[model samples]
Target: MNDLEEVAGLLAKPEPSEEVVARSRSRLQHRALGHGARGHRTLGHRMRSPGRVRWFVPGVALVAAGAAAAVVIATGAVTNAGAPAPVSGKEVLLMAAVSAERTPQSSGTYWHVTATWLDSEIPPMESWTSRDGKRWTRNEPGDTSDTVVPASISLRLKGADVSFDDLEKLPTDPEALKAWIVQRKGNPDDMSTSEIQGDPTLTLLTLITELPTPADVRSAAFRALAATPGVENTGAVEGGQALRMPDPDGLGEEIKMVVDPETARVVRANLLLTADGSSGSSDGDIAVTTDWTDELPATPKDRP
Candidate 1:
């Protein structure tokens, strides 16, 4: 099996510790009660709501699996011995950029993505966007609900409203892209000293995976992320070696991403907390699966 498939297999069979199970069960119960009383929002609403940041919470059955994946990664099981000696973060990103640049551009009436949010309280979220940027359809399988709306009401990346055209126009040069990202009102230049700083790398990573950006732009994003200071290669984790960066939100957290070396695509991401005298705790761990497809269902499945 391919490396990604192998990682997935390992992640699928977790042996959670008793403490982990207890924590997961408590979190699940808390979420159930909160959602039951407040009423859950539709996927469409959740997507557009700036305040709602969907976090992946492991379920009872998946607790061990997630822990296993993290442990294997922390222990370097994901690294391949046959691979060349480890390179600098910038070099690795440059390699990824080359791979992304060679990828074929996608064109279709709609951009469709099906993502399963493992360990999350919410169900899987599926979205379709019209090429002309006029229509959107979102489906939440857990609730058996679907919502159709204007593309103008779509999700934002790092609080920045962007469209397909904007993404296509992004600079491919790593330096240029870094300048562009830093100049954003939301991204502060003094990340090292500022009490608060936006994680531009997180924003770029989100766009690379969640948007139907052109291959060159995607590559540029990777290169830009590589050039970011404090970003480092954290050996193997899950689908591939992890590239880690400090959380820009100043929540005393760090962001770790598992990226496929062959394709330079992100396989998974984890938000781990940093606290003194505390074992590393994760605020959220997301496993994302994306597809840039040309076709989508003619109608929403659960349009009630």
Candidate 2:
């Protein structure tokens, strides 16, 4: 059978054992509670060796699997649906900017983000991060254990260590925000790189996924992206429209973001290889879900 058939076959298999399901759910719940200010003591119990398994919220995992299957089927039918009218990259970004600006301001004690990282060789890895940048929980599908880390950390933004307060304090004006990013980089030329992996445009793109960033700041970042040169609309991928920009590092890998126009949020981001036979060319993709809530999980079942 071909690759698509193989994927379909795998997804058609029966559900996991109830014991496995229960354990995974319990672990996730425990991790959620560990994000609380008083839950640090429970951190040691969750840490375990990383195993090759697909770890994600069970419900979300099923849905994502279904979605992946649909993508495989839809890819075969995309060409039959006559070509869609081209949309400008700037227009898309501007639309996203407007939507972002309209989002209500919210603050929370813990900023929660659930993300799935995909690669060819490894099973999709799911991770959750807490607000204080102190707790991170990760699991892989089929793995019975969750790896939890509790340490003071900062969200890496535009190559800088940005705390939650820093995110909130970012300038909301597009020009001012761009200037700030430039200043952070030390030199304007530093924003562009021929060998390094990051640049100003890439930094802004990354910022959009960071949930703790204020809505207006995100809006400004989108506006700055709209004004950036080299960004081009890449039509649609898996139902969402995509924008592509050449990697400034000259690595022949394009940064592609599948954007949800109505929400003005990126649904997925990918680093796709453009050059033939590039060694060590492992591509990566991320699917993100953000929750803005002040509630923390209750005390875990096994507290240290």
Go through the candidates in order and give each one's C-alpha lDDT: 0.47, 0.48
- Candidate 1 clashing pairs? 14-64, 14-65, 16-64, 57-119, 58-119
**What TM-score quantifies how close candidate 2 is to the native fold?**
0.59
> Deviation in angstroms for 203 in model 2?
1.5
lDDT digits (tens) for residues 1-304 of candidate 2? 4221222222233353444333433443343233221211121121111111112231221111100000221111112353222445655565566677777866565566555555433333333345555444343322334544332333555433566677789898877876677667422222224212334575676568644667889888877877767777755566455777776656565767777655767776653111010001123456666666564443344346
TM-score of each: 0.60, 0.59
* Candidate 2, poorest ten consecutive residues by summed lDDT: 61-70
- True-vs-predicted CA distance for residue 218, candidate 1, Å: 1.6
